[model samples]
Target: MNATKYIILLLLLPLLFGCSNDGINNNNRYLPNYGFSVDINMELPLYTNLQFTGNPVYIDQAGVGITGIFVMNTGGGYVAYEATCPNQEISECSGMFLQGITAICPCDEAEYNLFNGQSTEKEFPLKQYRVEVVNPSVIRVFN
Candidate 1:
């Protein structure tokens, strides 16, 4: 109510609401631009005869840190995403697992459907990278 009290409240207001356990602004914080590209043939072998059934493969690109390539059994389609948790950005506990049609984050059990990249329960979605199948054996991942 007083002038001194108002000043103290003003200074503490930002600290009160701007802080989070994840240490990032949940509402207004922008996701970092982690644009990168990877050539698949030079990185791993593409099994053409052996059918891939919704299995995720971890790949470490030269420039990009770590990425997960989810190969969907449906028509040989694939979805590639960064191995970083969107909720906390903890690189160590960020890899995802293929659960039916979703990729479950190991950190907080945040499940994201690899089909659309949307979180199954949470509002946030996993950061997805663009994938282009150059040929039957080659693929390119870009952010």
Candidate 2:
């Protein structure tokens, strides 16, 4: 009986370790679902920077919070992040700005990386959305 239990435990160990929230994080609190769409044209002057690698842009549309969306080109692909200050109440000062390669929160000054939404100063990472490249010229951002 003990041998059978040990075998079962060994088998279950791999499954338990595989089921992890490695890439996805739900650290943002007190946020409401405010879905929006953004269609970007790389040819346009406003979005021409996205054609280059490691360039981030701030879009002031989408989400129920004060901040909008922080979009960037990671060379591998495009990524979109919620510009709201994570783990804080939605308020006027909760919007974040794109400072170099990091998202700077106005209220608490928490910084998050635009590439992978990892927090630099705090434990909570910024919320992110799905980005789809419709074509070489067009990109869509949605949550």
Candidate 3:
């Protein structure tokens, strides 16, 4: 009886310390959280460049992201990230511009890798969204 009780206590101990927060505890202080969904057709003339790897395209119309979104063809697949710099609050200079495989933030000259969205100068990473390839010609981004 004593052995059974000890085993039950050990099993139930993990339940007592229960998770303090919901599974989704992530809270980014700088970047604004904006829900958006966008789809791009690679066949279109404007987005035709995306068909090639290492090319990134900026989409800024209606509902793409807070300021805009930068979608890139990483050769392996696709990646989409918020255009605003993740290190600081959205300011006039927070909008990032692409230069080769990196997005540069003019405010502090912070650079982020377009392929992985990792920062070269800081620990802040670009806000990324989920990408789904509807077909060979169409890709969707949502968060």
TM-score of each: 0.58, 0.76, 0.80
- Top model number, lDDT: 3
Model 1, runs deviating above 4 Å? 1-30, 42-53, 65-76, 97-101
Estimate the overall C-alpha local distance difference test score of candidate 3: 0.85
Residue-wise C-alpha lDDT for candidate 3, range 82-104, written one tens digit per residue: 88888887899988898988899
* lDDT of model 1 at position 70: 49
Each model's lDDT comes to: 0.60, 0.79, 0.85
Task: Report the number of the highest-TM-score candidate.
Answer: 3
Sort every candidate by TM-score, greatest first. Answer: 3, 2, 1
- Number of clashes in model 3? 0
